[model samples]
Target: EPEVTQTPSHQVTQMGQEVILRCVPISNHLYFYWYRQILGQKVEFLVSFYNNEISEKSEIFDDQFSVERPDGSNFTLKIRSTKLEDSAMYFCASTRALGLASAQYFGPGTRLTVL
Candidate 1:
């Protein structure tokens, strides 16, 4: 079975530094998303991408955040300036389609720590 995979299981960076988180979603899935969970908080949606363009995004995805599908297999999220509040477990997820019935496959997540 195929699954989403994230790189650099953990990342430590200084505040104001840039960080790019990478993910390879299931090969056959068509929609991809980025989400983050602050320590003990609920998972929050950041952005969604499909057809090589941003489909939707939440308010948390501000000017500092960007998403890209640079190639066939990789999806990435770049945080232009890391902040203390940006430290969280960032998750990558994908689904074959967009609907209530479609189940999303999630990656293990990449933990980001800002100092």
Candidate 2:
């Protein structure tokens, strides 16, 4: 079965630096999303992308953040200026369909530690 893969399971960066979290979502999936879990907090949706543009984005998706589908299989999240509060587990997810409650397949997650 196809599964989501994330690179650099853990990263440590200084404040104000840039970071790019990489993800390869499951093949044949159409919807891609980014969600972050801050330690013990709940998973919060950052953004959802489809058809090349952002389909939806939460309030947490601010000016410093961006996402892209560089190719057919690769999805990337870029943080222009990271802050200490940005430290968290960044998860990439995808679903074969999009609806009221389509279950998403999540990657193991990339832990971003901003110092």
Most accurate candidate by TM-score: 1
- Taking all chains together, each candidate's TM-score versus the true structure is 0.97, 0.96
Model 2 alpha-carbon drift over 4 Å, by segment? none
**How do the residues 1-115 of candidate 2 rate in per-residue lDDT, one tens digit apiece?**
7899998899999999999999999988899999999999999999999988999999999999999999998999999999999999999999987665788999999999999
lDDT of 1 at 57: 97
Considering summed lDDT, which 10 consecutive residues are worst modelled in model 2?
94-103
- Candidate 1: tens digits of C-alpha lDDT, residues 9-114: 9999999999999999999999999999999999999999999999999999999999999999999999999999999999999999665689999999999999
lDDT of each: 0.97, 0.95
Q: Number of the top candidate by lDDT?
A: 1
Positional deviation of residue 114's Cα in model 2 after best superposition, in angstroms? 0.3
Cα deviation at 103, candidate 1, in Å, is 0.2
